[model samples]
Target chain A: MARGHPAGPTGPAIRRAFDLLDLFTTARPRLTLSQLARHGGVPLSTAHRLVAELVRWGALERDPDGSYHIGLRLWELGALAPRGQGLREIALPFLEDLSQISRENVQLAVREGAELVFVERIAGTGAVPVFTRVGGRFALTATGVGLVLLAHAPTEIQDDVLGGRIERYTERTVTDPARLRRMLADVRTNGFSISDRQVTTDSLSVGAPIHDHLGQVVAAVSLVVRHGTASPHTLAPLVRTSARAISHALARRR
Target chain B: MARGHPAGPTGPAIRRAFDLLDLFTTARPRLTLSQLARHGGVPLSTAHRLVAELVRWGALERDPDGSYHIGLRLWELGALAPRGQGLREIALPFLEDLSQISRENVQLAVREGAELVFVERIAGTGAVPVFTRVGGRFALTATGVGLVLLAHAPTEIQDDVLGGRIERYTERTVTDPARLRRMLADVRTNGFSISDRQVTTDSLSVGAPIHDHLGQVVAAVSLVVRHGTASPHTLAPLVRTSARAISHALARRR
Candidate 1:
């Protein structure tokens, strides 16, 4: 390890570099050098040096206008993530089928710590607007895919989520740990999950777990539609079928 | 920059970290610590420290089998890349429309340096087998999208590519600098590109440029079919229309 003069405020060079990268989000996808320095909480000189290093490695790109954004090399590296782009590639065809047949929003997600990250999303004809985005994170206690993943997560993860504060997105969201536990039990028993206006009052979602070769729940697939347009019970089988297809594909690949 | 002892092999910490990340690819998505050390040409001890730092920053994940894979955090960050996932999100609907109508492979790509990286690819009905993968790089002189991007590239970049060694995939691939230059000129004049068995003998691709708000060629979209299945002239207008729709969408978004 390099144990000498650190460039940034306090952390190691790697930490500072990631801190700077974390500053870029959907709302602020592009940032100038000063904005990066201010948002990353580093000195301007340090920020400049770190940004130059990141640009050199193609982790970040400098536009002609002098602003910086995440680079293609990082995107290529990220495509190797098994739970992210890798899973999406194997499941996208099935997701497209579900989207076309159901004409509703299709989503795939995996549990990460106490939260769930959306791996892929396909907008269907007349699809309801969804708050979830590909690669975005959400609470494990809400959303159909999240509930399925939370249901199959390890004991520690379940406890961490249920035992902590549950964020309520709508009035229908179940915040009680006892009720949430019961819902999880039902998910395991029924092999599917439903979020009836839990995320948005105007929408309902049906989700099912996708298992790996070891029979562990590795991910969840879901379909979101307008609340009154479709019943969750009617949508459950369609979502479950797609989920099983993805599970089989994953097993074959593994 | 941290101006002290370089962690490994005399490079900065950021370079070493990215060099390690570049080791993960489609074939080798997962690696052991020893593999990382060996592939990255770093000392075992230095690899351990750097890997730990990366893991702490959520750039790498350690699997249960004692292997490391690209982490979800990196994927989330990569989603912010304007030339990668950002462009894909905007152009996907148009690409899907083209795919649904053509019932053939549809691809989206953008220029990075002298090469083009595939941003998205939708497999179509009875789609011919294509060698291109999403996030994979290809020569700017071979594929349909590559030609569209190269035709609009700066003079320096064109000269750099024309002056360098060109890899040939099939006997019909245009390799001579003079011939390649004429093909590029025709692409600009005709407002589209046709790659006739340049990459693979069994495939034919038609491409059109997607312009940004400034009307500059920021990306390219293409329709690829099996050789003799569809004439390039018949497919050119469909691809150009979809590309124009995507360009309009992008312009409106800006």
Candidate 2:
């Protein structure tokens, strides 16, 4: 029998499926059946059925410990996303260059709806430890990538971010809406942004926008180095040049 | 109105859903609705319905040009795959080291089922262009990472590969099952594999296995360089050391 209303649109069921998948995140990479049931807000039977289906389809896998985790099939499919793997593949050479030359943490990110998702990151062997993970989400006010993304976001999204809770990451993080707005304007005008000891006490990041053929900021590239070692001014040009090259490469693909 | 399989097991429906997703490979990144329907072997109505569901959930998205492609959400979920992003994350540092020091193509890969899927690749600036793509699949009988993985695969899989059609990329590629079998034995004995112009005409790759805490070969790392510039013997130690470092790092995580 059908699980739900037959006449109703399939939108809700699809959303529910996505919600179930979303239950597994970096923080909770693996979960038991009961845990998934509770987190997904589905009945035990429903959770069991869906989980079984997902596992069989390879969207999820049951580990040796019997906990469910995202599967390789999902990752393979995700590699097809232009904004995710496509962007990362194109930007990787430039990101690698920056990471190797500066010996710093290099990151590439894109704005997804209202959040910024790290597409790729290259950590320098001797670079300061920073809090960034690939495929992880972060706020749009504190990070160099975030500032570049926030600066170019649509008006409504910009308003929403500035109007919402601005979580402070460090003592130097700018949380004031007016100040953040001004900083975003400067990012647009100056062609780069400096998040000096913003996300962490010891890291400073310089970010620049990577534009599409239409010249809209589609992504951001950043070089995060140990604070006090080099000025953001010196790094801004490097970041901007990489971003421009990425933009040029992307334009050529069109 | 549950369609033809209203009374059949739900398993098939889920399998068909996955089958639809499986149709999008690196070679076929985008497809029209009819193309997807035909490839998936689902009726137009059913394919349309499932496509609509997937689209709603962001598992798929319609490109600006009106073609459907895999979505960012799928990539985000895929990033959670341990075999995919997990291995890449751990090996990235060591791979970066190899890339920087050698100034060549650094690759990380894992064997999924019987095929070698490239997990990550770093193309050195001005380095010889290699044919490998991240998330793309290659034969288990060719390339450096493929040899390492093939050497470690179960006996049945090894036998099946040896008995099957062996596509040759170059004259140096070992299509003779007997020769390939001996090469795999050598890889297991030597702790590394050398693919001397096997995949392409002008490139050579040296690969080594990355073991886990349990000493299982979980992944492989390689360096691809121009054939004439550096001998595989010279690159073997560097790749093996990096692979060992990655293994140590992964072992600590367990």
Candidate 3:
């Protein structure tokens, strides 16, 4: 027998459920029933039934204000993702060491398909604030971690990003496809990437690739500092060393 | 029209989908199709269809060895959960400080219904191996963080746990309902709790409650050490101070 339907007719239902979940992103963490209905392209009554099931299963929770947000159960399941929590767990000690020693913002992120998602970020008390959140997505052409990940991404993803709209964060952000392409090549050659006053005028980040046992560039680690206080070159070796240490640790894990 | 089913009969089908997700726990992170079928008590064909849909939506991923594991997208969605990542983000700095200071295991957790779920845990280089995992659940009667959370839980949840089976972890684990009731009272009175060799024979933990702006115990922070290395008295004040700092930080977050 087939799974749900003998003729596989329930495909649309499963897609609709995913569509409902996809409607809840970082930009829209909470949604009202009507908002969910509108965004999911479903009628209010349909949205109501889906939301009820999601809430019961702990995929979503109702706030005191009656708005709905993602629940702890989803987060727990997410922690089992090898690319997300698994990578972060192995790299945490190294990231902590970098954060403590440099007293700067240390971030760990990985490429998921074409986009980059922050897996973990440790903010130093006095460090310059950079706009990044764990599980948050950002353009692949604008940040240090992004550049390293984009550089190591497959050819198609690189082409897709470089071939599309590259949003400029600051005057220093590389929006030109040709120049960004050169920068990615530089990352490959230099073994590190730098975003100097790119994402934000006050911040500069140095990033390096973290490889898995199979030698795949599974993630990137970075140290962001106040631009005027330190040069990217001075920070490159430190970030690279930490990334290597993380890679070594990951290689040892079963 | 109803959500998945315009006829309103798809409620059980949607719920069965979630029940499948719930079967993936920390102890059983990956499962074969047969295992999921058996655990979910669904027909093998139904399990396969649902699993395929979930995998297609990126809620689940197949390992290279053909086993299924939670996917990165689910982790990304989980990151939006306020009780999980939200609390972890706020408490990370203090947890880092505690870990650095004592070179021990520092953990932050929150109560979800009747169970305590670990949100963040930082292990010292020399710290003893801990059983807790990020996004993992444990009984509310065995560990320091659990004790602190259980003490502050609502009346009904407290009664339900007191009325339920209290699994024993070690000889020192307090399994008697009457004794646990007194311990909960003591936690409220003393502003902290201790679990000496409760979860493991060679570990000791001290935990303190972290309150929200509403003065509710929203989370708990704890430090676990080798049993003979530190006295609970010496650790109590530190844990309490850290918890208070986190509470104050949480209060400042709109």
Candidate 4:
């Protein structure tokens, strides 16, 4: 379950089946039988058997080109995940309001272990381009939403991320452990976060945490814009208000 | 997986595993072990073992309340499905425009077997509330989008549907095979479909087909408004234009 690696030591048959699925990513959505056999560590015969079962089960789909990808059945199962589309459905209207008001990019994210997975993203017309896809994972250090999530995460998770080598995306990205810790603390105290050109040179983002009824920070919402076009102070109130609205919606639902 | 059954007979283990997954739906996203054992038609011990493996592989998550539901990792895998979120991503902007202009519920759907699965739905502000959920399935005979997709489906699929039982949702639903066949042919000739109060007495919808680069009808887009508020004639151009725009987006991406 760690990125491209197979799931930890289950029986080989189950592990092999999951490994074939784990081989797919946003960058590589399709795989040939040989690719599955080679990368998934199964023989061609075994790969064929497993794939036959998977396709029949609707876990994988065969294209007209004879390549395989994840199927609509898996997507239906995914929509039931509360942290995924369930949360996105409840948050979308508020995200739309923020996007329309700012005419910029809006994002919703949740922490999955020490990493963050984008749950939803909306880019306004003529907004600065952002490289984000729903269900894609990112490091805990670089982006505004990432920082806010890391700030509000459990202590064990914070320790795990802070104790590791931080991946930097741009020169403005804070890599030093002590400095990054200070930034997280600022996020908690200031009730928001600002990542200025941390992920990309032209982009800066302001993020705020979304809370559940229990007051746990279940998610984060952010606004990303061209760095020189807007100040973080100007965007902070907007992002914070939207995040609060989403949190209230979630609370009411719960 | 006919609505609510176990996956086909592959081997007991794999079929049981998939059956456990297929147990989830929008109406029932969470389940206890007893529920899984009973509904999934597996022994309690087998269900527990399968649930463990599924949880380890991130296909299911155990909630704090001791119930299990679909997990975010599955969502990550689902995002790779070209027919699901991948298609939704390309069509969303067009759907958004249509929703805003018409101030009605806009939907995108694709055929999965003889059934239609909704890929995306955007509800307009002040719009009549709709019950459709993303990734949820519906009969191909019920809605405007369903009729459009069923019309373009393969000959065998059409025969299979026409030869079987068609469930009617409202008094306006056309249940006779000949009438339904004529309606489909009209859809092909007119390049759009109108379902007047078929799914619900208060709702009427207009649907148009979306094609891939090869000109195959890969999806359908529709706009649903209150039956008394707007005629399908008034909505056809908007739905068709939006569907065409989405088709162009898919073509360009391909």
The lDDT leader among the candidates is 1
Q: Which of 1 and 3 is ahead in lDDT?
A: 1
Residue A42 in model 4: shift from native, Å? 1.1
* Candidate 3: tens digits of C-alpha lDDT, residues B1-254: 45453333334676777788878876788888899999888879888989998888888889767888888899998888888988888888889898988899999999999898999989887899987778888899989999999999999999999999989989999999999999999999999999999999999999999999889998999999999999999999999999999999999973
User: Whose TM-score is greatest here?
Assistant: 1
lDDT per residue (tens digit) for residues A118-183 in model 3: 998999869998778889888788788999999999899999988888888798888989999999
List ranges where model 1 is wrong by over 4 Å: A1-9, A228-230, B1-9
Whole-model lDDT, model 4: 0.91
Q: How high is the DockQ of candidate 3?
A: 0.63
What TM-score do all the candidates reach, one by one?
Answer: 0.93, 0.85, 0.86, 0.92
Better of 2 and 4 by TM-score: 4
List where candidate 4 sits over 4 angstroms from the true fold.
Answer: A1-10, B1-10, B228-231
Which residue pairs of candidate 2 clash?
none
Per-residue lDDT of candidate 4, residues B1-254 (tens digit)? 55666745545467678888898988888999999999988878778988999898888999788999998999988988999989988888788889889888999999999999999888888887999888888999979999999999999999999999999899999999999999999999999999999999999999999999999999999998998897788889888988999999999996
Residue pairs whose backbone atoms clash in candidate 1: none
Every candidate's chain B TM-score: 0.95, 0.92, 0.89, 0.92
Give the number of the best model, judged by DockQ. 1
- Give the Cα error of residue A50 in candidate 2, in Å: 2.6
Backbone clashes in model 4, listed as residue pairs = none
Error of 2 at B25 (Å): 2.7
Q: Which stretches of candidate 3 lie over 4 Å from their true place?
A: A1-11, A100-103, A124-126, A228-234, B1-11, B31-45, B63-66, B98-104, B124-129, B226-237
**Off by more than 4 A, model 2:** A1-14, A97-104, A124-128, A194-197, A201-204, A225-238, B1-13, B43-45, B99-104, B124-128, B201-204, B225-238
- Would you list the C-alpha lDDT of every candidate in the order shown? 0.93, 0.88, 0.88, 0.91
